[model samples]
Target: MGALTIKNVCKSYGPTDVLKGVNIDIQAGEFLILVGPSGCGKSTLLNMIAGLDGITSGEIQIDGRVVNNLPPKDRDIAMVFQSYALYPNMDIRRNISFGLEIRKVPKSEQDRIVNEVSSMLQIDQLLDRKPSQLSGGQRQRVAMGRALARKPALYLFDEPLSNLDAKLRVDMRTEIKMLHQRLKTTIVYVTHDQIEAMTLADKIAVMKGGIVQQFGSPRQLYDEPANMFVAGFMGSPSMNFIPCKVVSMGNETGVEIDGGAGTFKLPVRSNQLKSSEGQEVMLGIRPEKVTHKIESHLENSDFHLAKCRVSINEPTGPDTNIFIHMNGAKVVCRSTPDSAKDPGEEMEMMFDLSKMVFFDPKTEERLA
Candidate 1:
């Protein structure tokens, strides 16, 4: 059975519409992630799912039963918020077992569950210590442990790792992945971090302006983005967008790029280009897809070679980023650190057009 379903769910606060017809269907044991910039209604959708917020319209079903009117406690869901709300005076053991205690679990069973959870989270020795003594990461673990202790029908996490340091966040991310693998629990996580969304989610929902923009696996979002916003939002350094005019070159479609050496035509392999001819379009390509000319030929691929004077070069250990002018716009090319030339030097570079993406400049929609 599908674990959860949200059908045309919408939310409004008086005149402001917070969510606009959100829909999702997740299978059992799937790790679903809702990610977007702040105020995009990712949290609002999660709150509604957990019954922390009421839905304005539409139906929500948990295991085939409509749950729009169900209270949070009756929804069989547990949420871990951004803030680790650990009890200040209580020790870690008590904090983790507090929910079970309130449910009138026996003393022996509570102790057994607490010990098992602490061991799983690797906080066995710190059970006796109070929340004040634990580090940010440790405290986050305790908060997670509290939820894990219950084994609820669904786990809802709202930026649970956003409070920790960079290094610790990375560690906790891996640990959470391991935990999910072992437990096989159905989870719906919310975050604004693209890397977290990419690495942790079995499926991802990208939201913007209170609406779902795209929903798919990480590789699908990266390689075949639904629109220009998703194409620009999913990767680091972002995909480069250069404005050019679409033109016909024999049987194939091409783009005219005027990069100082004079205007040149570049072939584009898209059947959707018939209507785009003579129209302004945005050429989207990742920095890594733009590499040194030598490397392109070495890989047995023909490169669309262009010559331009380098404006800047940023060497970061493994690779060097060379910035230059292309079609009157600044473009970045990724090359080996050892092969970097100085700024102002004219160098030949290749655009791996095989991975190139085209967008309608006016609509901001992907053309191919």
Candidate 2:
């Protein structure tokens, strides 16, 4: 395990700049995830860190050693690829031991390492089989086992769980988490899946358009997102954004919401909104915060009640997605299955204004 540092890293191809001033510091044994949509430079950054791609500028250090010009062999890193990348002609044992063989490790040590890794990953039974003989999940485990055998200073996972089926993905995710916990190794995992980033990483760098939008814990990026993009991209089901005009309500202020039936002001407690009075700002709230009104909601000073006609009701076992309109924009309210009503029915929803976030309409940056 090793500490990793990327300082003012920038990458470009001829005229196109790919990574712009990317900076991330991961302490030893910390799991760091680089996450974003495709073409966001996450994979490119991972490749750069692995020394597979050259650094256009800036520095990358592993264990305080600058590896800007080093080859992959000299980096002391093991990488598990998205495609499994196992040698089809070789058995699982041979595939996992290939690196050890290349490094001229003794046969006894190689066998011991392979055996230990395969056992930990529960792929001991498949060690004699070829890549084609194993299923996708098994192949992924073999790939992880191959990386584990190396015992490198850093482990790089390049969307390693993306190829598995949904159930298998979840299972493998848990397996990987357990592996990290048991080993406490320094890891840099790259995935476009926010769910993976949220569940696995000690720290996350949310990237977009060659820029690091935000770098923090999952909860920090989820609850106190730096901008609208970070707020909208980090959460599952996305945060509901309603454009509302801030207005003065006696001594305090609130944002005006048009909830189909009628317009009402949802009380907002913020000193930041004082300067934003009468201006349009995007109010962001999570679906879970807007749910079926209950007595608990009535007791909170930050909660406000409103009735809206349900446009759609989507059931997902334990919770139902109650779709409604606020300020002419489609909004989703997650409700318990027992209280979920049918479409065309009017339901009272309690808005948890305490958790509401306001963004500047023009800049798309958080205001309050």
Candidate 3:
């Protein structure tokens, strides 16, 4: 089994702590992603797992064996680095075969493994070129090929595609996903790009300040973020936050939003409303959830329609972003390109509050 377990892991540089009590259990063949902003200790934790850094406390287990004290080579893992750390003087063939040579694999076996890995990465034609002579993407393929040739139990990737251009990054991301599916090897990938984490990982661990903020599938993180930090971090264009006071209307409780021209009450059914009356809360709604009203969506009890003046319109190919003012804050709504209105025009918009989330303004914690 290629399973991994991190128990109460901690790392420190004298008085400064980098990681604190991190715990994650990864099943065999799972694609796990470590994602967070820089200085959040993601790379530190990954280094500890790879035996490249010392652990101040706790244990790291691989396939049921504790590997905290084991050397990197003995940990039965291969790493692909962000820099595509290939030898500039050596050709791709030599670069890939060098590891097997150090391990004393027979010459014939080394040749066969090199051929297999090169073909697998579709770099067979470039095997004769040196790292300096190849494009960025080609060098990246060679880096992956070297790691694959090892056939190790765990593969660790440290921002492997960070050096590629935007288009190349997208291509490599797809390639990496395909490679993972074909090999079915356990992998631990580190990246700060939320898109990469969502697209490539079977499980994602969002970390901040040495603490794991949330851990789950991409869908869970996107739909039900644990707190404001996670909700804001995971989505593109981001979930909007509108500060408002909880108010009561007859038997229902909700918040009031003023869209420049008028005020509207959006009733919300949440247990937290029992004590949240008159308290400041942040109403969280994703851009896509707020859009041009449709007759079918208006049938839902939780759907709310309001007239708002569009302050700006940005066309993003797939959809147009309409910016409006609500509760004195700028709110973004996603509308079909043809349905979006020009700036300064009044438009009717719908809010799907069934999936809306609430958070405490002071604590930033989610409210049920």
Candidate 4:
């Protein structure tokens, strides 16, 4: 089984710390994604896990055994790199079976394994073609087939789809997910794309400045982000962070929002509302919640109506993004293309109070 554990793992090169006290655990068959912006040490962590680099302080455990001293070949793991590291001179069949040949497996067995993996990846027809002759996507499948031929306990994908085109990346993302489901294998993927991390991972570790910002199930990280960076990193169009003052008027405690036309009090559910009263805080809301007024929001007490003057509209086929200014900061609202208001027009929107998340503006930490 491919249960992996990184316990307070720290990596330093001379005086520069690349990974700082990183800790994570995942059971067999779980897909864990390391996601963040560039230079966040995500790829460095992946290399450490693969034994390609040494750990400065802490241990990495694979299947309950410490692997600090184990060589990459001795470890029961396979990796697919971003470059699709295939041999230029070798055909796809040999490229996939080369690992087995290096292990000195019988030629017949190697051929059988290569056939099985190639057929599974839908690359059977390309077996006779050299890696140089194939397209990026095809070469990627050969690389995956090469890894699948090994049947290792764990799989490491270091931005494997990063080199492909946008459409091919999406296609390969689905294929990788399907491959994982069918094999029930453990996977640790590294990527800077939040969309890939959200769609492909069961658990996500958001990294920044050589430290883990947050690590949890995708929903947990999406719904209850640990900090402002996580809130801004995980979702598309990102979460809107409105600078607002927490105010308490009578029994009502909420954040005051200036949505261009006028100011309104919207209730924000938070345990720290009392302590944060009169303090400036960041109110986080996804674009979907601040949509054009809907009938369903009428039954909810947490939903309030507010008018915002549209700055612009970005139509993305299914849903249009309505841009508007709130307290001098631009915020986006998700609405249907047909229902979206024209630019410079005023529109009524339902601001869902229940879904908003509060954060400390100074520290960027969640305020409850």
Supply the global lDDT for candidate 4.
0.91
Which residue pairs in candidate 4 collide? none
Candidate 4 Cα errors over 4 Å, as ranges = none
Superposition-based RMSD of candidate 4 using all C-alpha atoms, in angstroms = 1.3
Span of ten consecutive residues with least summed lDDT in model 3: 267-276
Q: lDDT value for candidate 3? A: 0.92
Pitting candidate 1 against candidate 3, the one with the higher TM-score is 3
> On a 0 to 100 scale, what is the lDDT of residue 231 in model 2?
89
User: What is the C-alpha lDDT profile of model 4 across 132-168, one tens digit per residue?
Assistant: 8999999999889898999988899999998999999
> What are the per-residue Cα lDDT tens digits for candidate 3 across 271-335?
67766789888999999999998788777887889888899999999999999989988899999
Pairs clashing within candidate 1: none
Model 3: number of backbone collisions: 0
User: For candidate 2, lDDT tens digit of each residue in 15-110?
Assistant: 999999999998999999999999999999999999999989999999999999999999999999999899999999999999999999999999
Top candidate, metric lDDT: 2
lDDT of each: 0.88, 0.92, 0.92, 0.91
Error in Å for residue 122 of model 3: 0.7
Model 2, backbone clash pairs (residues 3+ apart or across chains), number: 0
